[model samples]
Target chain A: MSNKVIKYILILALAIIAAIVIFEFVSNNPDKRPSNPFEFNVDNYKAVDETLISYKETRQIAIKDGIPGAIAFSHGQLYLLVDDYLQVILPGGMEVFKRKLSEKPNCIAVDRDGFIFIGFENRIRTYDKVGIEINLSEVASDKSHFTALAVSDDLIYVADAGEKQIRVYDKKLQQKHVFNGESGVSDVHGFILPSAHFDLAVNSDNELWAVNPGLHAIQNYSETGRLRGFWSKSSFENDGFSGCCNPYYIAFLSNGSFVTSEKGLVRIKIHKESGELSSVVAAPEKFSNGTKAPALAVDESDNIIALDFDRKMIRFFEPK
Target chain B: MSKLQSRRQFISGCARYSLGLTIAGVIGFSLTNASSQQWLWQIDPFKCTNCGRCATHCVLNPSAVKCVHAYALCGYCDLCGGYLKPGHIARNTAAENQLCPTAAIERKLIEEPYYEYHINEELCIGCAKCVEGCSSFGNGSLHLQIRQNICVNCNECAIARVCPSDAIKRIPADEPYLIKGGFEHGQTL
Candidate 1:
């Protein structure tokens, strides 16, 4: 063999061996997920009560606990969503408490006595006013993207994003009734995004006013799961449904008047009795500028408590 | 002729050994470099959109987002502008007057006149309510930082990529932070 040929062969052999060793080491070591899985023991969670820390002279209110735009106030206490955790603001802002649930909480509601019920990802958890978790139920039969929830008296209503149906459950968590996307029944196909800002509210008439944001209307249903009526056609032209995802949050006032927050235009409109919008609570100021005003509640003073998505804070607004 | 052939053979053997050594050294160098290189996610706070999704959408339960304070530039008052709401507390401490929603921001009396504001990151949800107030009223003393201890360090962190502010950036794990003064974005450098 020629000297040059033999030299080239020896160099190639050395390179191959080196390549093999490097490949072996690289293949042996791989990126692994965190070995310490996060523990969800309720004990690991604590509440940061803003109310206790400092004093305010003008507002006279001491501290306001942080709440997600998805919150419900019951019996003068605040039930706030703080990043998957639920916090309850006590009266006088004295004590603030929290409960870490097994699943992320999307919406919360409380009865007269302050029993808290939370819904998220096709699951429902009922907690006492003191932050004690009571019941956890997987309601949606197919786990079909449970989006919105509303509880009244002894019944709990759920909106499924996956299926175009609204399922009703008794206090015992039994499937007493189900409303498919019928004329009167609210469904994703006929109403709003099944997951949009809790589209369901139980009114004094024992009828369910389900806000169908996608449909830009409110479908009414009797307690017996009967189709009663619907308000879809808007009286005002520009006042009609504003966003592709129409009314995300629906708020009802004392005199049976109500308001809806539109997503696309980022505005809030008041729906008159004739199924027309005449009052503009918050007009669209800019494009895609609207916050996630998903949860809406009316305080005793009739002020609106809205979860502002852009602001990342709870905004308090008075009706004009 | 026989002597010439022997000399040629010897030279070939030495060349082969030299080539082999050179090739081996090159391969070793490449392998060493590959093992030491690391992949990381960086945040450019400048592009951050301040989307509320950071609070809820993270895969981590608490979402590694935390509230950070710039103490060097802090106003250091008994009543911090960022820590308290728009109004002053009654001549004393009142729950409704404070600005912190979760009460995660703790205050300690550093002196009779100066106060230290510390954030309990575990309890902070990264709502940025304090950040808004501080930057607006105080010297932007409070800010949000993605804590590495709890961060899962995903192959592609959603917040870092989506941040409209472009405030996040990857730093070496050994020295994994880019500290700033009170408020640097719009405030004086």
Candidate 2:
């Protein structure tokens, strides 16, 4: 072979040897595996301090589309949520009734007489237990995004996100009074994005509890609209509201204790009957990876119900 | 002329050497980046709907979805909200009350006052029935979160965009989780 041919072959041989060495080095060492991507490792998962109760799968509730926002039960019937409508099912998971509407239904309530009241965009839709639409009334206020519904005797309380107050109406849909805002006396207008609105049941002394998550406090009130006491004041540390939306949802346990779900910091708190604060749910180690629970409901068994904003799943919790 | 031809040959050799170096550099960079940042599959716990899609919807045969326990948040009740039916047992632990469809969450008496409940990740099929029970009735001690190891980490997480509360978020790998303190006897270090 010529000298030039030998030189070219030598260069090619050198290049091939270099490539083999580099490939061998890379194939020998590998990267470490990711930690708990499925969130299955119990040793590292957070929220390890609270008491855990018995939990089982729900066979009756099936979420079809979008995430479920609010869940309620009326006359032993279970209600799961979709974006545009509320799906009503039997306790055995039978699809019995569905209330179809044009807009999204965020909050739902049923009175003692089996009257179903739902809060939708800018209006409240009332129905009999049979899923028949009764009345659809538009609130006179603008930017009135209704999110919560509560029925106390003949009075219905609607939490209007726009007006920033619990609007009071008679069973027949008459506007009787407004609890907060420019015209109300109790100054509950101080709340920030009060998403789930409700009033507690009347005690033996005819007392009730109402919470404004925006203000981070629960107010005690009488049927006559008297401000009796404030249960708890929210502090911005060690289990308090930290996000722009403030407290998203609240529910009362059977023992008179209550659970509050907050955004930003994203923790579920348990307040004792004496008003001592204890954290039942804190954000997981993978913080800010999940959305807050925007709405809450307490079943007759004192189980706390929350709709996870991120997962679009209906979550339940028992008091520790 | 022979000297001139030799000089031209040297010039061509130099140009080829430079071109090979540039190509090698580009290939090296691409390979390093490709293998280094491959841990992509993740579940946005916030956006997951607990629809049992994790059990059925994953591209993998075993479904990348697995059950996760937020142990710090658990209440450790005898009749755990996530483990039992609301009225199935009269405030006690039993087979009739557990919510796990595959009986994956196991409970053992750790001591006189405390019970240890754990999920068998291998047996878990990602049906979030237990998570729903815990979040609604109990302290939300048991929740469904994606394990990154098994996740394929698609360009778009199938469950994240559909989330109602928008709870799912991307976190860094080193300090990956958002730890919360929950129930008694639960430890987070």
Candidate 3:
């Protein structure tokens, strides 16, 4: 063969070999794979428009153990349950009271009278302003997990995720009634808590709002277990709760707006009383991937107090 | 024959033997050791939707696929989403209370608020029940992977052909097993 022809053929063979090697490397390597074909991408829900975000993180108080359980804001005093201590810190960042509990608290709530109500796994313990254990109530049931607590003037409500019911107690911690969400109303879907993320909050009107996470709705029930009213939005959109269950925690502003925290695509959002999207408090970027939802509480000044569970810090936000 | 003809014949004989050895070496290399060039069916944990086909589609009676735990990514929650059934009342060892149908997962208390979970591959049916629960509620630490020892390594994987998520693909069998790297989507190899 001519030298020119031989050279061209050799070059062609080399090119084919290189192509085969490249193809094999790119096709077989997991890193070179394309974006997942069946990905459940709810990442778009994390993005928030600048105009819709009404709150900005102003400060963060890192807990001592760096492991926060739950938080409750009452009368400008921040009540944080971290490790085994119920720390009551003033608005000025001064810890006025710190009580070591018998065990780690699952949830915490403070009434207007400065009574701290702590919910353990299966029981409720109340401490008066003088740090005296006022009431110790054993929530009787095998499957009674006290996930959340809400205190009103005359009553205290506990969300039992295990039993999927709301246990109502009087001021003396006596079992008043059980609201199982089974009522004459046709719209009541009851409290469907899939995981352990059930939450309870008393709004400005003293109406108990329970997060039916599985239904992705906030339900309102009377002290007698009557379904009063509820607001729910279940979707992947900014206004709705997503995933199997969400809106892990919910609080209310003085203006009666709802502040909610959700898992999956972790976000802190505000909703109107009528369940309309008000504004974004903190978008998903504020949290790490696979982070549990932050515990939500609005202080006396309407400052949004978010206990970032993954970060182990208390982040305070204010309306823009 | 002339000297030149004898020399040409000797060179031709050496070239033929060299070519034969090269071909034999190539065949031997492929038969014993799977070189990097080989392709084997593997499930990408990132793309797997846990559609429940891995257990049924495999030719083996007990499917080769199994659930794996990424210890680094585990949250060690007392109420593990992977170990316990959804809306489970108590964290116990009851078969009905467990998420796994085969009861393959063994849960041991690590401390007050943490628990460690281990999967028994013998009983695991590759149903991906635990993987789905963990991914949805907790960290996506529990992921589905094909056990190489159990896999017969079929030329055409039955599961791959019908993977709902199309997560199963032919990967280089250089790595022992596909493990869930983390939330970042990194792979071991």
| Among all candidates shown, the one with the greatest TM-score | 3
Q: What is the DockQ of candidate 2?
A: 0.02
Candidate scoring better on DockQ of 1 and 3: 3
lDDT of 3 by residue, A96-182 (tens): 888888987899888888898999988899998755677899755888888899998899999888787889998788898987884
Candidate 2 Cα errors over 4 Å, as ranges:
A1-46, A50-62, A181-189, A194-210, A222-226, A233-239, A278-288, A316-320, B1-189
Task: Give lDDT: candidate 3, residue A244.
Answer: 47
Sort order, TM-score high to low: 3, 2, 1
Q: Is candidate 2 or candidate 3 better by DockQ?
A: 3
For residues B2-72, what per-residue lDDT tens digits would candidate 1 score against the true structure? 45567789899999999999999999999997777453454334334334445554678766877788677
Cand. 3 TM to true fold: 0.63
Give model 3's clash tally.
Answer: 0
Off by over 4 Å in 1: A1-69, A90-96, A135-138, A183-198, A233-238, A285-291, B1-189
State the lDDT of candidate 2 residue by residue for A31-66, as single tens digits. Answer: 322222322112222343434312322322335576
Give one digit per residue, the lDDT tens place, for model 2 in B19-108. Answer: 999999999999998776333444445444555555554666566667687665454544454666434434345567566767888888
Per-residue C-alpha lDDT of model 1 across residues A1-320, encoded as one tens digit per residue: 99999999999999999999987565433332122121111111112233321211121122244445366767787777776788776434454887777777777777666778777767677788787887777557654656567777878887765565687877666667776644433321344341223367765444577776544568777656566777774221334553224566676666566667654335555676456755655444421333354357766655656666565555556643
